[model samples]
Target: MVFWILISFVALAMAALLGLILLRAHSMAEPPAAYDLRVYRQQLSDVDKDLLRGVINDSDAQRVRTEVSRRILAADAQLQKQSSGSPQPKGMSRLTVVLAAALLIGGTLALYSLLGAPGYGDMGLASRIEASDNYARTRPKQAEAESKVPPQPNPNLEPGYADLVAQLRQTAGERPDDAQGQALLAQHEANLGNFIAAYQAKQNYIRIMSGDLEPQDYGELAELMIMAAGGYVSPEAEELLDDTLRLDPRNGPARYYYGLLQGQLDRPDIAFRVWVDTLRQGPKGAPWINGIEAQIEDMAFRAGIEYSPISPPGAAGAQAPALAGPNAEDLEAAQEMTAEDRQEMIRGMVARLSDRLATEGGSAPEWAQLIGALGVLGEQDRAKAIYAEAKTRFADDTEALAQLESAASMAGLEP
Candidate 1:
């Protein structure tokens, strides 16, 4: 109520000032100059007196009288015209002033009431800065919590495979300088989403390489780090991506993750460009390609651009060598076991792979492995679930679907 009263008072004062201005303009119009015959008559009489007193000759007095008579006649004519002409300040009236004043105040107050903030209070500069800082400080805590939820591999794996892993662990422990053992451990650990152990094993492998690393090694290391960080490309992972790209610019994983890092660094243009190029050159079924495609569209949207990547070729791509339930040596050992033991171990292995893929999604090859394993185990329901999930995850990915389909057909599973 008090605020409204103050506004009303100020508005009234402004309206009054506008009214005064209009009235002053109307009143300030120049009034017609007063033209009277009496002044001219007085001047003519003075000239006649001067002549009578012998101050001027007759001809000079006549000339002066003629000029005075002309002035008096002109003045009389002007006064007559003025009486017939319009009144003073003819166009501007008092009503116009009132309307103008009312309009000025009414328009301003109406606009303010319509557009201005009527109830919002100011959060001063300091408070606003504090709020912004608090927001910035809170996000990492959420990310840290997510990263700490360690990935769980299935507990019920094959006893033989578990024994093999145990043997490998023993070998790696005994021969701590064995680079090959460390590398194998890293691959197996990552395959299981034991990212913490995978990271340790990869670091050991990196140390073994002694700064002589391949782009594939760097890319794999970056992947391990990102998985350990719950998919966030931290600065350390970014550096590994950088190293991967430096070694091989065509490295698919490096290019994709580098784009992600660029997006995180708020360089959407670079991110968009890198991801687009990666899509153009990448194989249709690369595990990272779907993620890259999504990120590209998102960055393009945010950068206010229209983006459409060229479709990947439909031709069959060169696939990596197949890795099934076990290697030849492990299979030979499994063949020595009793038939029931062999069947139980095979089911256990397949179950673990299924659990791993379901819990923590894997690469295209890993997905193939899980699908094939499920088919071999004759578990059609789980195989269908895996297929459905893979299809959903790689919705638009023709190459990945093709690979899974081939594996399904070979395993003689239901479509």
Candidate 2:
């Protein structure tokens, strides 16, 4: 009787345990709770009352009642089973103990293989997440800490001429064929008054462009070359102006500059021609045109030529003070020469200038000056040819080469 009573008690405990497990599993399998079970029960009661009062149809009442009853019975069954202790471990037989030990060892090994070290994977993930959150919350402070180190300028720089020369030399070395590099080197040399070096660099840059230089580059190059000339006229520079005009005849800047170059070369006739051309092509009241007009008037006056000048009325509204006619000195300078003689002189000059530039090895800026001098001397053909050859050779150097071509063309030479 005692053994039977013990068996019965054990069976009851197993049933209760089984019921508790089923109840817990069922609860876990449901969707996560959005509201209390008590609220659900209250809703059910309200619906039941509505049906009883005929506020809802019989069919709806039936469906609602059936669902509620099913859930309640399932809950009751789960609770009863949990209380009965339905689950119990097998007896402590030798075979049972061996199997249990084997399971325990296998489970530990499986967990280690599948999940890595117990606190180094998922556990580590949680730690990382916490750290990331902390970092996000203090991100501004972290950024401020990082920004405490101020930016630093180049260490090897001494400022002024030394730095400029060093940088230019380095840039030239690194980018041998780069026009901008050449320009920079030329700039440094010019600043140092190394005109010969500057001119050489400028010409080398122009020579590299094998006919790929653009119009804008041509205009800028002409401007720079004019500045580089330092007041000497050269056949090469005349050829550059010719090429510049050919590329973009309508470019007012090019036209105006060409006029100035012509003036320097002692070709007032051509200079005045270009200045007039600018006036016709550019806006009537444009500052560039007005400036060129002023220049033309001044030149005309110096040549003993008459032109409309802005002058104040004299006493009794008499015309403005009239200047004397061209003096012997002015006429001698402006004397007309045969085209043949002019061409011969230009040819000789170009030959000499080319030799100096090539054998003597001038700088880029000096070369620019030499080119301008050629234009002023009326060696337009030689200048144009040089610029054209440069364009053909330095196809990649658009700006410098284009300037050479434009300046040459503006001087009325074919490139």
Every candidate's lDDT: 0.70, 0.54
Q: TM-scores, in order shown?
A: 0.46, 0.32
Q: Over 4 Å off in model 1, which ranges?
A: 1-147, 150-159, 313-415
lDDT of 2 by residue, 150-235 (tens): 44333331123243366557767787786545655665565565555666666656666557566655555555555445533244
Candidate 1: C-alpha lDDT: 0.70
Least accurate stretch of 10 residues (summed lDDT) in model 1?
A: 27-36
TM-score of 2: 0.32
Clashes of each: 0, 81
